[model samples]
Target: MGKHAKPSGKSAHHAPGSVVRARPLPVRSAVRLRRPIDIWHKPALSAVVALAIPDLTLWALGRLDLILYTSAGAMCALYAHGLPYAARARTLPWVVLGMVASLGIALTAASLITSTALLVVCASLVAAVHKVVCEATRIGPPGNIILTFIAASAFFVPQHAGQVPLHLALALGAGVLAWLVCMAPALIRPQGPERIVVARALEAAAGLLRTEAGTGGGEPAGVPHARHATAAAVNAAWHTLFLVPVHTAAKAAARVGLERLLVRAESALGDAIEASAEDAPRDARFAGAGAEADRLGGWARELRSGRPLPEVALSASQAEELAGVAAEEPGPRRPAPGQPRGVRAVLTRLAPGSPLLPIGARVAAGCALAGWASMAVGVGHPYWAVVTAASIYQANTTLSWQRALQRTLGNLLGLLLYTALLPLMHLGPPAMIALALACQLGAEAGITRNYWLGSVCVTPMALLLTEFGSPVPATTLIADRWIDTVVGAAVGLACCVLVTNRRAADRIEVALGRVAAAEAVACRLLAAGPATGADEARDIGWARERLTGCLVELREAVEVAAGEWWQRALPEERIAHAEQRGHRALAGLVRRLSAPALAA
Candidate 1:
């Protein structure tokens, strides 16, 4: 008996909590339409609704007090970015709490210390602390709010201690409005994009597994397209994960379960690869594998359509038989008679490949430049700094530098353009309100594809936001922007140099090694035949978790490897061949483990 199979008399059904319905992708078109309206529409709507109360309050407060509006608007910007909607829902309270505390501390500190340098130092330190806290606690969106509150409050610190309460109240008011804006989406149908993406990733992984097993090394048709699609799907999944907040204990638990499953699957795949690689195949093995691939392709399509899995269940004895085959060491051989072609195909498709976006020194450099520039310039607001910092991000450092340059140029032009328009538009509450919404939408629309386009909207938004309280000369606004931009671009680039990462290949190698080892172990166990005890399921599950983790790590490492200039220079052809072979082995192992015939 294999080490991991259940005993002969035990029930094969998993424990009640073990199963999780991997949700399929939400029904939505992949391609976007009407770029301007599409991009701006949601954020604009959100801004108009969310900003109304706060703007109105500023207006009611005479709109001539620069302190309130600039401070409040800075807070509003803090509330802007996140997991689009899900994080919006989960982040409000945390943001409010963080903001209030920061406002109070800034007010108190300002009262005690009157030096401008001290104020900047304190604010930057607070920014660093907020970032660290968010990372440490996984507090997410609220962390930004805390940082924003500190920056905004720093601008007015060294005020009488008695005024601290008013500053906090104003921040509280703005935060409340921001929360409302973020939450107003209940009025419309909510699409859970993040949830859908996660589900689709599982499906894609399954499809990949099936395809590798079925093809048996014949030139893969549409191989590049399939690989790209899978890569895109994975990217979408990760992005959504970052944005959304799983608020409920149940949801968090589910995430843990899912993470565990992925980990196991990766470990098992590695073991399978080592075992299979030892055995070379005959022509008949290739032909039979091809037939199975076609069947698994059908299953992949079915999964995409949200079809249920197979209804048949193996008895305890059959499961043991199945487990034994999976644990066998891999070498080229024909499948045991009557093994389902579909099952075999599905297993074959599970190979590793390139990542979606490669990360490297260039990205790190750009990020650091952006972060430092915003800090040093002592800008009109820290939000500008953050946006500039974020805008510099790219798949690599060179790209990051390119984007940073683009943003600086764009901001310079946009600021000048806004200056020209300043004389024509009245600096009244009504005009400011309208301009705010317009710039908010404009910024949101351009942000998706082009940083410069987004900067246009952002520039106007920052400038106009500053004008809410006092009438600053358009010339002054323009000058400040240019100075900040230059600082951000220079500092951001330097950061890229300071944080250079050259270990991408090593990470990829580690992932590959892990996968290979797990597969070998799994195959050896499978070769030993069926288990005698139910407790062996623990070993099986543990192996599966390790295998899954390795697969995920490999995928991530591959994604980041190419972003480094060095990874592209390696013997990619050899690596690619190994991946193909390993994928096939893993799929074959899965097919044997799950086959109904093995139950007999």
Candidate 2:
């Protein structure tokens, strides 16, 4: 039997002498609340470019008042972040179309309906769709909440049916401009995004090696965390590379070479895992692994700069070994089996059993309740309440709580900033436009660093946007905002508790099952000895890839489940066992590949 197989069928198998430390639930919660920030300036620049072109074009046409509609369309530029240029080109247009579709629905509903209740219902549906689409597509941060916020707010704005078509056309036109701005970066460095992703993966691998080497023996304390980081980087690198089609033979060969380098990086991680298992000496492994990692990083930089590949002193043999492995079993060129492909596939995946459904339900309920509550309490703009509620719903309850706190605090400080700037913004249309632009830039620049800091800018920009139509009393706006913030956040959090995701633990179990199945298949292949045919080799390769993918999914599930407030106790021991056994299986494959060379 495979080491990971359990007779009880509850606990997973663990490698000999491997101990899985069980962290206290409180400690896990506290640790997860604090995530480090990685700032990428490219997206900030992209936002500015996207917003500027349309705003300037409208100003030149003496129709600066239409900038609000253009700004709505410009928000589409925020999608497809971290994607390769080719992928962004395809994704941005889809995002723009989706945005336009949502806006059109909101405008048409607002024009036809006079009752606030019906409008709230319509907005809730839009919020639910936005939530599901964002989660299903993995659009990452500044996600569907923003889209929902804009669309829901549009529902409250009174509009004539005659004006709806022109507004929709404006959004579509601006969306095209946003798409252009996002794709412009590819002109200067076609391969830059993929290179940066691979380089970061190499760096993460180096960090893991260094951490493991410092521990000297047993499973390194930081090995799991470092491994998680390396896995994410490698996965991202693969996705980026896969998105770009290699039309020319030269591009194809170059892509294959880069993929081989990525495989070498993975092998280095496997070596570190094995060394940690066997109590290899710190200095020897560090010296060898560190040199190889640095060499890969340097090569990544060259690739980014479009320079010729440089020869490496330390990794030459390892590179040749990886090449042999590649020849024997090439990595997959497409997404793994069972991944969603088309619109139908995506819809099928988001059915009732999908984990994301509850999240979408929460957004819908929270936004609708908040809007109704605000209206009942006599707040001037109920959409602010809806937007606040939508923004606070995250992947789990714990994150939602944190976001609520951040949003409330940020808005308070933002109110102060808005008070100080109201006088300046009243100067003229140009002044208001420029200040709004600055706030947009600041929000984009700071959002990745801290949500609260981004909120500071977002709050002011939102306030100024209201002024584009007519000037209201500053004091009245401020009072309504304060009341709406408190009401929305309270109602949003209430919904989080009410709509509990009891299936979080079930999802974790399912993920563990996948990890076990994949590991078992790989172990069986290893036991059957070396491959007798290309088909056998390919099967082994696929099994290993599936195992790796399952492990990543398992980690994500465990983290998300740990953060939920009311979910059942997660199978931490079983999870640890599965992880340890999965690593051992991978290490076993690595040893088999290198055995003949070591003996010779």
Candidate 3:
């Protein structure tokens, strides 16, 4: 929505008294293609390359039936791409392990259980794990869907206890290869991920300026979302910076350089917030802020160019603020007292009442229903149905509905593509294998545009991967997957509606209560006096972060709840009051800690 669009609840200029309504289900917006991510090719290229060696070697050896295991591990390369190499190195192995474990469970259950019904139940349970764990780990794109797809497919494959270890070993080998492939760029460009995140911050900041200038003809809506996005990008940059250890003087300097750019991005974001409250009419300050935004955009370009971080001019206060932030990080490896990390964090996520558990339950129910329905309807590939249903469970009912629509449309298109590619499959193994590889690559590349668009490649790719085994008739394959897709989408959407995430709505109350408590702490700290020692300053900064985080969580909780079909009305007045007070206290902390580096 651009210049002419009206302000919605999330818009920066919405009146406080205006009604806040749930977003009616998205249609045109759900399927619309947006701009590509900053380094969209990284995961796409990484996944396809990681898959190629395993696929070709298997094909050459007449063992392409094992692609499921290797593909599971190869897809590991898709994860941790956004994390700094230091973090990526530590995280990728765990991702690989999780993938393999999922496959193992599926295979063992498939081998032992004679009943097809029990097998579907086992597959659904695995899907539930895949959904919860992936979200808990915060692993990025392709996410649990890839894991579930592979494991569900494996559940249908003929397996014995004897074959499990060898298949697992193949997956482990491919996973090791995937790790190396993802990490290889570090030798040449150690800070590439860090730089990419900073560049994104700059671009987001620039968009704010364009809106301020009212030069681009759009609603000036999504301004709030952009502000939050820029903040997230900057936080990611800081996290990446923390991942870089500083044993050498040279490394320390590189980190400081990147930090300076991040500070500028934050400063631009601050200006956008101030600009939002003004009726400046393109006045001098707005003009100058616009210029500053342009400069940030240019520096962002420099960051992505594989060149050195461009020298940025900053005032003494800005430098001090940067130093203050650097001092506050406490290194990336350490977890805070309340924020449980690693396994503890995973358990915390699975804790009863956690929002993620509800979503996981939805996946399990939807997958079971979809798979059982497929068998009832006489479709042969119930696993395909299972995977589709598993993939459709999102954070809430509305989003799941959106994904369902996109998935159904994409699968239909993918079937048409498969028909057209019948001749290519007849070209034999290499051609068939290569075509599937292209689908993998295309899925990664286009999926970011829209899930359905990516599915155009994914659905066909899923079908083609089956061809690696004894060939199935194209007509039978197409018809089965098509039926599965429709059944899965319908069942998944139903589950989403029936399985309301009440916790998300409840979380809004929790967040607000936390905000009220945090605001009181911040207010007391502010009243105590200006931040003096490193300890006091750190406390203030931590308090600010917590308050800001709670506000974001509260806003998000409200949004998710409002979209849910059967949720109760939110306490909008309380939420509004909490955010307003929390923000005021946070501003005080920011001003005390680093007024010049950040803004008022």
Candidate 4:
């Protein structure tokens, strides 16, 4: 179709009979350094404390050789740091349990089998499971890396039937400690996680406002990325609010306070849409957007600090809606009857034709191939290669390639750092313990800066961890790790190239259908609204949220499919049309439900 011609049909990403091919890896972007994440210190500090208490206790008992089990458990602290406390409370125990289970399974297999080949296969399967389950649970950041690392490492450890239970128990004990350490902050600020997320939503909304708040604005000029960020942040803030418990008066008050600020930020979002969609510069309803942006930023600053939440006088309908929200709080929105719920939801996500399943298959194939290649290359510990392969798999093929590149570079740099630390590490367990803890701290604290930076610390830490059990020849160990890194990165990329994700293309169609369905529901709710009651407004808001979520999912599916190396040509035009329509409808619903909530 010509530029000015009406689009008659969806255009596939590529023409029929054309072969899909991989693009150049994102080498520079993968390694580039950036600022730390907002909660970087939480997981980093929690890991340090989690490891220290158990390590010191083990040392006192003269059982420092069992550091692997404890370290495995301690790493559980790295997960769920991004979750609200209410969710974290329920999630942390499961994470700990999963960690222990992974350890137990690996240990049992190792004890029963003497074949390094069999062991590698078992560990690779563990990595695959970890990848799928962690994604299903939405365990944010460092997702399956820690789980795979623990399982793969355990697969090579010398274990007997007698030792498996004890090891798992040790892991469980230390994981409990990590859980306590992670939850400690709740004692002082029960709403801390909610506050941070709410602040982030406000800040993101303010960012969008500033983008369009220009004096010489044309079409309001909000960047796509800024709008997307605002939408995601506001969505996350509401999720956190729902997950918060409100049985007590104090907790209820705190939730309502945060909800008030979030309501204002969401209103700013709605106004931005109204202002941009109508292209009316002099519209009075959108005139207060700048003032709203300033309030959002100020409220965000206050939320971030230890100060009280900013007070807002919600109009009557807003108050009634909030009161209803409070009444409905302490749980996630219920799924409709006959729809997948809880475990079923996870299973549904993992069911046939799901995009994540292909990635899991990729991990299994990559790790196995990398391990076999490492063994063929005569590396002593093929599991290192397995772990490296597992770490490289990300959400899509392109990201996997970038991680493969980054991991390779980071491992080389990490080996150099290990050599430098080798002398200090020879000072015995005490010095080794301190250095390992320091590396743990750096890995968590700096990972948000960039994955490659975290790998730099991780490499040295892994080498030091080995010394805890029994000293090895530094040169031999270093040489083996170097070899494994090369083999793993090479083979992992090979698997990614060879094992194509054709399902990714199909997912775009499913996502588009979901978006259409959600949009229809949103349209119905919007037509019925200027909701008279809290329940009706809540219904409109829910419809809008579902529609927005479906749009996000559609975008993700399209992006992932587009990045797959051997994917069939996706219907790019169809995806764009669906997303544009879905988002436009969502913006309309936002105006209807949120914009006037704080107009006073």
Candidate 5:
């Protein structure tokens, strides 16, 4: 039996000393408050260019009515943020195609079915499918929720079979435009994305070093956050590097150099974690790590600007240490596998036992309920309520609550902006297009900073979209929005409460066990002494990878479970202990791999 396993006969329902308690709303820390400006510039520019150029052209051609379909396709621009150009090249097209496909299905369903009940069912099914696919693929933010929002709303749009192809063509054209807009930067700076990702990792490493040094070896509260940030940055850097195809010797060499730098960064991270855990004194090694991190960050900046690669420099001891580790010759890089193919595979992966399944079900239920409640209460467009409900379903109930509050607040303020702009919009399509573009820019600009800030623009843009078909009175639109917001937020949060994830704690225990098991396996391998052959070395590498993956999974589980309300008190202390042990085990593995060089 595993060390972390529950004692026999102690029902899973009742872990020893565990008590059910309601987790209070984390009001202060729920939403990130710091607003950064530069990070959003490129995405905002991409969205505006993607949306405006086509819209203005359509208006010029007297095809302003077709802008709705085109804008639906262009909305795909909102995705692919933080992805490397290589990944974005694939991701953007996928998003556009997915949007077009969903639109086609919605249009067909609307044309074929006359009954509202059937339409609702169809929309609910689409939401479920989107939820499953997005979660399975790990598409990150702006996930399937936005895609579902667009499709669900379109389901109610009156359409004919003949109009489907033309509308789809419009969407396809705009999607192509969005793809181009997002990919354009790659033309000027082929390695820019990878550079940024690597740079971020280095910066995060430096941050952790600073925190460790400043705390005088005490485990500060900020240390975990910094560690997690560094881990995420490193993971993203590797993924980005892997996504880029190396077609030339020059590119391959460059990639190898980046990989070497990345390994050093990882080593530095391991050192910091171990030092912090052991409460070691700040030493020359720590200072050297910080300097190396700064150097790597500068290299990233130069790469991003298409400047020449900086010369690598290190002290004699540092060079020997790196050379010792490099002598081991780590395992060959295996191609990262793609997401599982086929609906069956995806569904199986997201089966009832999966953590994401409950969230998907909650989304479907909330969307359906919000739509029905809105219609019951005589709101003209139930889709708004449906979309609102979809948007409120985040990774956890705590986040969902924050989104609900942000969405409501932003929408209310947006309605006021819409009211103020109503007179200007009546001037012409050009004015309306300009206002929409501005709102989109604003949305993209602040979205990363804060959800509410982004929604301030998103709400107005959505309201203005209603004006494209026919003029609805501002008062009526405002009233409906407020009513829908209330209904959807209330319904969505209610679903969150009713559908509690009892397995959350259990999953945390499982993750803890996995981490323990993997750590033990790696530690055992290290204790057996350094790898004597290629196969043994590869085995050690795989073991370390498994351990790292388990640690990542464990951290994610703890974060999600921590945010859940009304659950048994988690064994947080035990989880922390496991993490510390895991880190020490990893550090030991790193030391063993570098032992040959260190000894020399």
Candidate 6:
């Protein structure tokens, strides 16, 4: 064995060749779950605005006869879009479209189907349709199902048969309003604050690099402190990327820049931690850099108060040199640490032949099975289809199954809460509108902290979205929700079991290529000539940063794949070894660039 055993997270355990954790889920310590306030704040603000808008509209229109709840629910969709799931914005329009289609089908079917039992079956079928479309499109969050729930619930609302057209128009009107609200304000470039945050994160990464290079002296206390500061900067950048449209040229460029910074910071941290070698001396150049990091970290905190970033001087040559290092190409490397290969297997099961298929067929099948079953059983509502679709969306199919269970359980309880609240609140338009706003905000606030809590509000919001213009029999509504939830949860889970992916190995290979390319760029910058090559150095730095991001992404993907299926990919140990080796090499590259030759 080599002298270095390889760096491992003290708590992480992995199966051989598998990226998934081989160990059981740990009981985390009572530390508060760390969510960035920045991410939380946007949803909070959006929630408030969403509620406020509907309230105003209801008052202005002077009509409980309107589909204010539809607008309210659609606005809730906007809130979900801002979250950091993969391809978030790309998924929003599909979710909105799903909502529209679900409403259309549910309303059309409701007019023809009279039996309470048949109505429930029809609602479930419609919900299944919504789930299928969303899964096909990789629509936003599982919350996409809520849109279906909203439309179906409206079916049970007691509207005079003749008023159907007016109700449909009102609902469509509300959804259109929501679409405009989402599309319009996104034009405003709130770049100043975001830029400052990104700059701060970059500076912190630079400072950390400098500290680790034998340049600084501080109590070991500073390491943890610096890590904390770096985390804040990273989280802030995540917030910025999550909110804007990534496809736009400017936003895309900024995202690329920010991602590069993130990659650099992650690589630098991994390198610093590894180089310390369990008790290595701190580098001399790191002293000033550590202090600078601390200073930048503090400045970042102040920036939260809307203050501009305080300009601090850097040795222009050193800064330029470091930028160059970041711009270099990625080199050949081994696999990353703690990746899962099982998810890739599960993905393959779904696609069979086409690995890049966007729609998760396995997931859709589960939803369909649940919906079909509920229909056969004559359940009151197809809450089951919604539940089934909502639960199994994790990175791994196994985790998705667990989430589906949790979501179903949570939704079941939430339905009870709605039952109790509906009668007490009296399903009038004003009261319904007020409740919608409150629930939307509450759901948004709780989503980041506790999914269960968010469901509490989400449940009522779903239920009330139906009563926008009419009331439903409370007993039938509540019963159907539970039946649908159970059926959907069961069906969704079953599909996950039946359909799995098989091409995790190929994906991992592709990911490795990206990492190697980025690393090569980084190595080139490290080997560059003097500071006179500043422009070239800057470009190299950006390239290195991009490589780092790609590696992180690949590592995460591999881990997910490994977790879902253990025997499908490269040996878990090999991947981990590769990642550690990569980390060491990258760190070496960073140190070389920061050396006297390059800095001078």
Candidate whose TM-score is highest: 4
lDDT: worst 10-residue window of model 4: 1-10
> Which candidate, 2 or 6, would have the higher TM-score against the true structure?
2
lDDT of 5: 0.74
lDDT per residue as tens, model 5, 1-600: 011122223333455237776666655554556656335777778878888988888888987767778887888887886777767887888889999999999989988898776676678778877887888777776788669877987898888988999999999999999998888887887777677777777777778777766675568788877887777777667666656665566766566666656655566677677777554656733556556556656666765666766555432323443344344334323422232334665676577688887887888888888888888899987888888888888767777887888888778888888888888988888889999999988887777787877888888888777777556888898899889988988987898878887777777888999889889898889778766654565566456556766777788887777677756766766887898888778766655544432210
Q: TM-scores of all models?
A: 0.58, 0.88, 0.90, 0.93, 0.88, 0.68
> lDDT value for candidate 4?
0.79
Per-candidate clashes, comma-separated: 64, 0, 5, 0, 1, 77
Candidate 4 lDDT over residue span 1-600, tens digit each: 011111224435455235454444455667778888798998999999999988888888888899999999898888887777778988999999998999999999989999998888999999999999988867788899998988899999889999888899999999998889989898897778889999999999988887766535455324555776788888778767767766777777887898888877776766665666545655553466677788888888898897987778665556667777777646453422234546888888988778888789989999998999998989888999999999988777777887888888888999999999878976867888899999999888767887888898999999877777767899989999999998998898889888878787678778889889988988787776577888876677677667766776776676676666555555656776786677778777766755455654
**lDDT by residue for model 1 (471-550), tens:** 57777667766776676566655664345444545556767787687667656656766445433543443344344445
Candidate 2: where is the Cα deviation over 4 Å? Answer: 1-39, 278-287, 296-332, 337-345, 530-538, 590-600
Give the deviation of candidate 2 from the true structure as CA RMSD: 5.7
Off by over 4 Å in 3: 1-24, 213-222, 275-287, 313-338, 532-536, 593-600
Mind sharing the TM-score for model 4? Answer: 0.93
Alpha carbon lDDT of each predicted model: 0.48, 0.73, 0.77, 0.79, 0.74, 0.52
Give candidate 4 regions above 4 Å deviation.
1-22, 215-222, 282-288, 329-341, 595-597
Greater lDDT among 1 and 3 belongs to 3
- Comparing candidate 1 with candidate 3, which one achieves the higher TM-score? 3
RMSD of 3: 4.1
Residue 110 accuracy (lDDT) in model 3? 82
lDDT of 1: 0.48
How displaced is residue 19 in candidate 1, in Å? 48
For model 5, what is the alpha-carbon lDDT of residue 249? 60
Q: Which 10-residue window of candidate 6 scores lowest in summed lDDT?
A: 23-32
By TM-score rank, best first, the candidates go: 4, 3, 5, 2, 6, 1
